[model samples]
Target chain A: MTYVTDVPEMAVAPAGGPPGHGAVPAADTPTQWAAAYFDGYSTVGLLAVVGVLFLTVAFVGGRLLRPVVPTPEKLLTYECGVDPVGEGWAHTQVRYYVYAFLYVIFAVDSIFLFPWATVFAEPGFGGTTLVEMFVFLGFLTVGLLYAWKKGVLEWT
Target chain B: MNDTLEVALRLLAVFVIFLVLPLVIGQTEHKVMAHMQGRLGPMYAGGFHGWAQLVADGVKFAQKEDVVPANADRRVFQLAPAVALLPYLLVLVAIPIGPDNAVGEAIDAGIFFVLAVMGVGVLGSLMAGWASANKFSLLGGLRTAAQLLAYELPMLLTAASVAMAAGTVSLPGMLDAFEWWWVPWQIVGGVVFFVAGLAELQRPPFDAPVADSEIIFGAYTEYTGLRFALFLLAEYAGIVVLSGLTAVLFLGGWHGPFADELGWLWTLLKTLALAFVVIWLRATYPRLREDQLQKLAWTVLIPLALAQIALTGVVKVAIS
Candidate 1:
């Protein structure tokens, strides 16, 4: 009984391949597809479990090892040795929100660009694919230029 | 039986990464930064070179008082450090440590998985900041979110360009693509990835989110004891993951001069080199103003990343 590596075999299996011809048996059922997908991530799942355990041990060990003597002054929020000021909640600047909005635009652009790149490298793609990508990029460039001109790009 | 073996091996690797690597890297960072500042760091801890300094620090952190602010949101505050550290571990699951020593079984979208998980760390910082009930913590958290959002674009774009060049988003596949003619063409994307990665990791020049002098350690301002140690662990873990990703994406993961049997060593060497650069940057540079960081990301790095994508497209077309 030879051991099987999971991912590469599953990835190379044609969608409708004949029974017993691939690592996965022929089953058009959604359960089979889901199982295959889950199998691919099994190692990751194991690692996640280990990771949680590692953190739990560290936190628990620290709790046991550490002293617990909390004074009221120690529990007060730190303010550069000054006495506690007003409420902890303060009005944050809107500039950070604006950066997030700008990030959203480019993030979508990147999402589109990744799939395009993967498709562009396919055997049949050529100069036409290249031109289409540039056109897509052209729209993004225009948006960026608009943002630039409006000084949204300015950190101030 | 094979599946169990594979799982056991991966668990050992994860243990090494989570438990051991951080201590070694943290020590190296202290010594390197100290040397840069013209001081001998940790010289007496392990007898000769203070190699046991990290061990001592760990024990000290373990023994310190765990404090929570009276007005703080207890649940979020308690959980933030774990949240921040968790993603770093998840990212490691997808990282190919060597040609043959990849911890987990390979996922086709390995690099994408890493980037997406890394993005989750900002939420941890945000939680820490907002739950701390400190104004400085809030500011730090918000700044962290903004900075991560700003830099993440260029980092993704640069990575996408590398993916396009290699024609594979899988970590091991990218390594296989580095046969001879690939390195020179990847130089631009590589540089962009490094610079944006620095911002993503919030290391020097780009560390405004945690500027100690400005915000008293930012989101970590109110954290004490073991929780603070966890945050520091998260940071060092972030550095290790980013450095490993850099080696995989640009410097060719596990591929170096000499024996193929020693591939993991090469990967370690490359990762340490990149991590040292990060520590060097922290030692040398002053923190950039928040606005300067934003401007650098949006105006400079983003455009350069876009241009790199265009250049990669043209070169790919021409060569094909």
Candidate 2:
């Protein structure tokens, strides 16, 4: 029954809005705001727990009803009927690690963009935020272009 | 006490939705793919067009032997499916079905929360691949990680465009702030998000990670019985989440005629329609080669997503 309000919208009161109509009141303590914020996440965590319980139930049910006979062949790692060669932990291509490094850089950039996106078009903060973001993105674009020129983005 | 009861009931409802929607999508895929390929898919399973086909499959899988490969890292192999399956369930909790208090839990930063949680799902396949102790599974896992790295940028960028246009990161807030024009405005972001989402889920065309022809089902090569079925369920659940998100972020979430009363129906309709498109894509296109897959994400989708963000910024400033 409790509505979870958008924190950013409430925290940054619009330029000319009167207090107590829809804008958050000063009387609301930060702790109350923090609790309300985490209440939503706690629900997410609870749902995740429920999901795990559901899968656990299904697996338990399967364990009760299904056979568990394990012959030597049955338990063998499958490699088209032949025994698995060498180790399962083979040395993979280094290209994947490069992609991962790129992902980390851009992923951080993307995270910064989320809050910027939320606040970018606000009443007092429109043009300035837009120019700032484009500058940030300009730097990122250079990095991406560098990767492309170096053939690091190429999968092969 | 009252709040506890309310939370309990909401969790229960979301749990029911989490269990039901994926099976429905799975059955729809079977029938749709069957008809598209000119074959009657599972006509007799539930006595009418295989209505209960997935249910029957569930029972059959439960009855089969639960095989854990001798070489597998037993705990990680067992836990991977749960890791894959739960993130979708968590994302579903934040998705609003209708206007005004209709979501399971309305997070403040709903867009960021969903994107972050969804990214964790990919690690499940990676874990499965590493733990399976099969060469193919390892390859599949590595490929999944690489594909995720390539595609996640576009997905994040596209979703960011919608958040910027709406001027909020919350899903319900985005819907509340929705205008009819955003459909055209965010169309490119919508397409990129959906395609990247499909690729993230390892659906066909971007399913080089799991292309059975080459890698023998990839990270799932060593799984059987209910364990294997859990992975399949994760895939379908991913489809439902992706479709639901695309509907909310792009087409408009639960906005239509008589939306006050019929909002949830509109949301459901849009989600299912997108799910059909997902199946249609699988039936239509051949899987891309691994290089092509990475190229599509980095070269095409990422650039397009960035442009869409710039366009969103321009539009936002112009209209204001």
- C-alpha lDDT of all candidate models, in order: 0.81, 0.88
What local lDDT does model 1 show for residue B80? 97
Off by over 4 Å in 2: A1-27
Model 1 stretches astray by more than 4 angstroms? A1-34
Best candidate per lDDT, number? 2
TM-score of only chain B in every candidate structure: 0.96, 0.98
Q: Which candidate is the best by DockQ?
A: 2
- Assign candidate 1 its CAPRI class: medium
Indicate the fraction of true inter-chain contacts that candidate 2 also forms: 0.79
Top candidate, metric TM-score: 2
